[model samples]
Structures are given as C-alpha cells and as structure tokens.
Target: MLSSYNNNKVIYSGTGRRKTSIARVKLIPGSGKLIINGLPGESYLQFSPNYLRISCAPLNILGLHKEYDIYVKTQGGGLTGQADAIRLGLAKALCSVNPENRITLKSEGLLRRDARIKERKKYGLRKARKAPQYSKR
Candidate 1:
C-alpha cells in the first residue's frame, strides 16, 4: 500500500489478489467514478450490478462511495475473482486514506484476502481430482 501526490493531487494505491486475479487499485479524490483498465467499470464488468456492488463494497460500507474515484488495473482470472480482488484493493486504499478505516473494513472482513486457488492436476487424473472411468471386465 502507498499514497503519493501527483500534481498536488493525492492518490492512494493498493494491490489485491484472489484466485488467479490481481487488481491494482488507486483512490483519487473526485466524484464516484470507477475506471478499470482504461474502460468504465460497469462496461468492463459487463454491466453486472453484482460486480459493481462487490467492487465498491468497501466505500459503500464507509459511506464514502461518493467521495473518491476508483481506478483499477486488473488482469487474470474471471470476473468474480477480479471483482473480489478489486474490493480488497479498494479497502486497502481506503485504509491508507484513514487508518481508522481498517477497524471498519476488518470487521466487515473486507481486508482479508481469499486464498483459495485452482487445484493442480496430478498425473493420470482427468482433472484436479477426477479420474478416468475404469473398466474391470
């Protein structure tokens, strides 16, 4: 997590990961706009309200949804994982903005990273755990 000033404007940044997804988030003081990977957040998320809500959960929890703009660069994984990663990153940035926010974010479990990832496939297995059908005739 880091916060820096650009042209006298403050920017708070944080990184988050979920599954195979990684999101780099920045919080800028402005109207509540969300831009991801140079695209509008809504369009990037395919206009799914669930994704929008998940990505902005932290700000909504803090009643600062309209206070800061969210900018993110995310890659890998599906939309669900990306959305969660963004949420965590945003929460971290908010904490940098106000350390006290950690208490609130933590209580809501927003600061915790989801560690579950895809299981590796073993030799002779069809998938991570599924094996080919056996014929004992």
Candidate 2:
C-alpha cells in the first residue's frame, strides 16, 4: 500500500500473505526483472521454473510482464508459500497501476488471497488434529 514518487519515478507497492509467508512487493517501471530480499529472484527461488512462473503470473496475464521491475522483501515462509505471496502482491501492485487491470486479474483469480493456514494444535493432540493412539489392553 506504499505508492509514492521517488525522483519523479512512480512506484506502486502492495503486500501479500499466504500461510506464514509475507511478501512486500514494489513495482517500478523497467524491464522485467525480479529482485527478492536483495537477491536476484531466479537464484533466490533456486531456479525453479514453477516458482518463477507463479510469481510472474499476474504480469503475464496483463501482457505487461516486460514493463515493470519487481522488487520484493519476503519473509516467514518457505519457497512455495513465498512464491504464492509474491503472486498476490504483484497482482495488487498491477491493479494500482491501472484500475481496469483489476477486472482481468480478479477474473483469473490472481487477486484472491489463499486463506488456508496451519491449524492451531490442541494441547491434548500431537498435532492440529492427530491424537495419540489409544491402548487396547
């Protein structure tokens, strides 16, 4: 939600969350390049094609993939969660660029935040729902 002008350059930003992961995304006008946590996105994502694709899905859908540089600072989740968070964040940033883009992004379901998260573990259970086996003596 941080949109501002830096030296006459417009910056659009958005925040995303998935599971325990959170991503802060900034969109700046430039060739398509992704930087995450001060590292190149490709390397940070471990060169995974799937991760790369998921993170860039929104831009591709709008055919504006090459018009913006993505800068992200993500934490608190694994790669999968982080990738998804990035996708959502990017979609939001794109929407701020142009309101019309929301229709397409929303239709494709890119704007929806995944709400599934780890359930809280109960004190009597070994996990969120798993219980210790009962003895049948």
Candidate 3:
C-alpha cells in the first residue's frame, strides 16, 4: 500500500512504531522464519516468551504463521515496545499481501500503533509531572 511494489518483487514491507521503538518489517514467502536484526526471533527476544508471542500474534491470528517469513529491524525503546512494534509491522505487511485481512487485523487490534510514551522530565520538576514533596514549616 506504500507503493514501490512490483511483480518481480516478492517482498512486502511496512514500518511500525510503538512508544519510542521503530520497526521495519519485510514479509517474504518462506517457511515461517522470523529474523530480527541479526538474531533469530527467539534469541532476539530471550527476555520473555511473550515477546516472541507478541511478534507473531498477527500471523497466528490469521493462521498464516507458517506461510511467510518475517524479517524485521527494530530500534529504540525497551523490549516490549520493540515486540509490539514488530507486531504492528507484521500486521501491516500482511495487509499488503491481502487487503481483506485489514478488517480482521483491525478487529484483532494488531494494526493500531501503541502511542503511549514516557513523558519528558521537565527542568524544574522531578519527573514529567511530578514535583518535590513540600514540607510545611
């Protein structure tokens, strides 16, 4: 849907963001391999099994988990954000393959980008909106 596609090109790609994490995803017809950056999906998401689940949820939702390979490069934010970004990216790439999937993806809430982000700490405040506790004299 982002253009730059051709009959010779067998890859569909999409960009996704969550919090501070940004993921670039490419979907290729292959044997369900998920490679992130330079690491295998599991190795890349070693902290928790949830990350792997999150990354593959979209494909699983559509029962296409074994039909395509997911290639992703993600940066910024924590692991959760990266996982979620990957999920969103995967959903988009799937959409490129079949626009009909959009409704199901949307119904499953995969295509929506999570927008929650950490608020910046202000110069005079202890944190984004928190201030030092006042002690009355």
Candidate 4:
C-alpha cells in the first residue's frame, strides 16, 4: 500500500480491506483534510456525518484527527465497507508514524482485519446454507 515519499516531506501509508473493498491510504502532516477517490471525503460520502466519523475513527480515537491529512483510493464494496477500510488503513499508517501507536491501535481493535465475506452457495442448496424445500409426502 505504502508506495513512497520524497525526503522533502513525510508521509505514512498502508492498505486496508473490508469485505470486497480495498483502500490505499496515505497520511501527511497538514491540517485535517481528506481526499478519496479523487473527491473530497465529505463529498464522496455524500456528506453523511456517520460515515465520516467511521472513516476517521482511528484518528479521532488517537486525538490526531486535526493533525494530519488523509488520502485514500478505494474501490469495490459499498460506502460502509470503504469507510471501514479507510479506518483500518489509517490505523496502520499511524502505527508506521509512531510505534507506540501499535498498542493503542491494537487495544482499540483497529489493527485487526475483518475477514468475514460472502459465503459461496453449496452444490445442493439454494444458498450458502438454505435448502430449496422439504417434501414430506
């Protein structure tokens, strides 16, 4: 996820995944601002305060919400998935900036990957676990 940064500036980065969504996130020293998928984070999320909060949970939890700018490129899944992915990626970037953040992030459960995804349907079932019907004649 972390590509590179020039020596003239400092940037931290990481990758985050949720469901089928993936986000590449970068953090830079600047006033709080967010750019995601070529759109401002707020605008991209349709100005939904809830999703904005979810995407910045890790920063808010660590009191760094106003200290850095966030950049995210995300695809796949829906808005919620992308937001959670950003949160996880931001947590990882924070850890890279300060190792001490590792414990905090871990304690906040931000460093854990969400592995749950859609289950495949079984060969003889209509769904992952549901059967077509029961005949008792």
Candidate 5:
C-alpha cells in the first residue's frame, strides 16, 4: 500500500550523455541547492556558475521560480562535458516534474544530447588533422 505523502514528493531520475561522458540526476522537490553524491554542495569537482545558470534555465521557463534542490551524480566527463550533461539532466528533471512542459522544452532543443568529441590524432600527423612540414626538394 502506498502512502499519500509519497505521492506529493516524487523522485524522478534521468540520464544525460555527451561525448564519452555521462551524467545521472535525481530530482526531488525542495529548497534550492545542488548536491553531488553524499558530499556537501561545495564538494563537486565540476561546479561552475555558468553550468548552474544553464541547467536551471528549464525551471525558470516552467515558471518554477522557487528553488528546487537537485541531487546529481555525474561521471566520465570533463568540466564542460559535465556541465552540458547537467543541463540535459535538469531538462529531463523538469519534464518529469510536469509532462505538459515537454513541448516548450523540446522546442528549445534542451533535451538533445551533444555528441561532439575530441578527434583522434592520425599517425605521422602533428595533430588530429594538421600534417608535418612537407619537403619537395
């Protein structure tokens, strides 16, 4: 038997992928604060103001002005990769909160996963595509 209290507080989980990185997010309705793992808010290695700004954009668009703290655990990504992953996670979380907002968020393309990665360097090349000095003598 399920209790009524559990109904109001929904636990929504979502995953975001970018390049080789992956981010997993669990959203619960509460005060505004970002948590990664069991550590405090300041413990996450990829904390960035810009990331938070971009990730939280969906909340604002959905008219959820008040703070809704999020608990996220992300791995296999760099700082920028993690940020974009978080953004996707946040967007999915917003959708879970209310399905009606899907059209709005979808139109903005916030749900899309970025698939750009570093190009591997080719043999005999200085870089991914740059070639060594050519001699025609």
Candidate 6:
C-alpha cells in the first residue's frame, strides 16, 4: 500500500545540457521564477536578457502561464548557452512532473540539444569556409 505521506514528495529529477553549459534544475508546483546559484532571475537578467528569454521558454510551452519558480545552477558555458541548457533542463523536469507532456515537448524539439556551433577556421582560410585573399599572377 502506498503511504499518503509520500504524496507530495519529489517524483522526478533531471539534468539538461547545451553547448558547454549544464543546467541542474528542480521543479516544484509554484509560480514561475528562475533562481541561479541562489541568485534571483533578475540578477542574471542584468547581465543578459537573451538568457532570461531562452530559459523561460519551457514554462511558456508547457502552458505554465505563471512562472514555475525554478532553481538552477549552471556552469561551463556563456549566458546564451546556459539559457538553452536551462530550457532543456526545465523541459526534462516538466516531463518528470507529468509524463504525458513528453510527446508535446519532444515534438517541439525542446528535448534535443542543439548541435550547431562555430566551425574551426583552417590555418590558411580566412574563416571556417571563407578563403584567404587571392592574388592573381
């Protein structure tokens, strides 16, 4: 028999990764807000608005009109990458909240890590694909 006391206990935990960033997220029933390493979301925003927007997309997609009040600690990447990581983390966290939502989130490609990144420049190439100055003899 299941114990009634365990009803509200945490049922899921998930990790999200994007680029070089990793986001550890925890989801609980509550209004949406982001806490990064104990700092409020606003603090992070002061550094990068793009991060805040990308990180918040998951909540909106889940029809969580109000904020979910997420707590995240991310490392090893820039603001944009961290935000993308957090979005992935939050989506995974949501799946734990309700497995039924997985299909919808997956369909939106929220679960997939973006593989696009800057290609390395060749020694003689001006850029990844651009050629160096051409001199006609």
Q: Mind giving the per-residue lDDT tens digits that candidate 2 earns over 13-115?
A: 9999999999999999999999999999999999999999999999988999899999999999799999999999999999999999999999999999999
Q: Tell me the tens digit of each residue's lDDT in model 1 across 1-137.
A: 56789788899999999999999999999999999999999999999999999999999999999999899999999999999999999999999999999999999999998999999999999999999999999
TM-score, prediction 6:
0.76
Off by over 4 Å in 4: 1-3
Total backbone collisions, model 6: 6
What are the lDDT scores of the predictions, listed in order? 0.95, 0.95, 0.88, 0.92, 0.73, 0.76
Candidate 2 — worst ten consecutive residues by lDDT sum? 1-10
TM-score of 2: 0.96
Q: Order of candidates by TM-score, top first?
A: 1, 2, 4, 3, 5, 6
* Over 4 Å off, model 1: none
Backbone Cα, N, C clashes tallied per candidate: 0, 0, 0, 0, 0, 6
Error of 2 at 80 (Å): 0.7
Tens digits of per-residue lDDT, candidate 6, 1-137, equal 11122346443446888778888887655666668889997787575677677887767877884745677888987787888888898888888777887898999889898876768898888889999778998
Q: Write the per-residue lDDT of candidate 3 for residues 47-128, one digit (tens) a residue.
A: 5778888999999999999998888999998898999999998899889899999999999888887788888899888989
Go through the candidates in order and give the C-alpha RMSD of each one to the true structure. 0.9, 1.0, 2.0, 1.6, 3.8, 4.4
Residue 128 of candidate 6: its Cα lDDT?
91
TM-score per prediction, in order, is 0.97, 0.96, 0.92, 0.93, 0.80, 0.76
Better of 4 and 5 by TM-score: 4
Among residues 3 or more apart in sequence or in different chains, the pairs in candidate 1 whose N, CA or C atoms overlap within 3 Å are none
Off by over 4 Å in 2: none
Span of ten consecutive residues with least summed lDDT in model 6: 1-10
| Residue 20 lDDT in candidate 2 | 98
